[model samples]
Target: MVYELKTKENENSVIEFIESVESPKKREDAYRLLDLFTAVTSYPAKMWGPSIIGFGSYHYKYASGHEGDAPLTGFSPRKAKISLYLSMEEGTYKRLAANFGKHTRGKACIYVNKVADIDVEVLKEMIKQSVNFSKKMGQS
Candidate 1:
């Protein structure tokens, strides 16, 4: 069975969204991430769903035939933690992640309390790899 993708790119203002975040720290960190991601991905910020700020996008179809469009890299300034969304397979970068700094992670989302908790250099490398990985997958 095919599942519909709930998160999608929308015509929303990323700056506006950042300004709406309640926490002053989160809001500032959101702006920092916006600059960081934009500089790394070299793509303009785009909103994915109501919360996530995304960069470049690509389409993917799994072996099971599940397919959808997704950002190559993105993040959401959630109430609990900032969610860093990257496209590489979980654990595919264990060595790299070891130096990624204070964070918890799931399959695709990395949770961080703030930007200061992570090594920005490591995040940049991860974002580059993720963009390449997603682009390659879409080409297949």
Candidate 2:
């Protein structure tokens, strides 16, 4: 089942999820991610699924015939790392990743340990690209 976005009443649960992280550094990193995502996307960040913090919304269907609505882009604060979702066609992020400093990509997701580990300007550009890509996709 698809997870719905959280409501204002669910804010406490979101806060508590952030608070439950054992590492202070990771907790702060998650907040920084939240801030950066909000700043760049201008879409109110909402807790979606179990651990994902998402911005905006879109509908998608895979070539295999699976279809669903989901956040246009999002991230997750996991135990080992932070995952940033950049919604783009396959291979579109390759050039950006070359200048992104220390990061690992899995499909559309970019994983990093800390924001400082990557170039923020490149990140901003990537975010802009992803947002624009999603916008265009939504229009189609």
Clashes of each: 0, 0
TM-score attained by model 2 = 0.82
Q: Estimate the TM-score of every prediction.
A: 0.92, 0.82
Measured with C-alpha atoms, the lDDT of residue 98 in candidate 1 is: 89
Question: Per-residue lDDT tens digits of candidate 2, residues 7-100?
Answer: 2112435567777888899899888877887899898877776687878877666677665666777777898888988877557587787888
What TM-score should be assigned to candidate 1? 0.92
lDDT of 1 by residue, 36-140 (tens): 999999999999999999999988888987888999889999999999987675576787798999999787788999999999999999888888888898888
**C-alpha lDDT score of every prediction, in listed order:** 0.90, 0.77
Residue 93 error, candidate 2, Å: 1.3
The runs of at least 3 residues in candidate 1 whose Cα sits more than 4 Å from the true structure, single-residue gaps closed, are 89-92
Model 2 ranges with Cα > 4 A deviation: 1-13, 89-92
Best by TM-score: 1
Q: Which residue pairs clash within candidate 1?
A: none
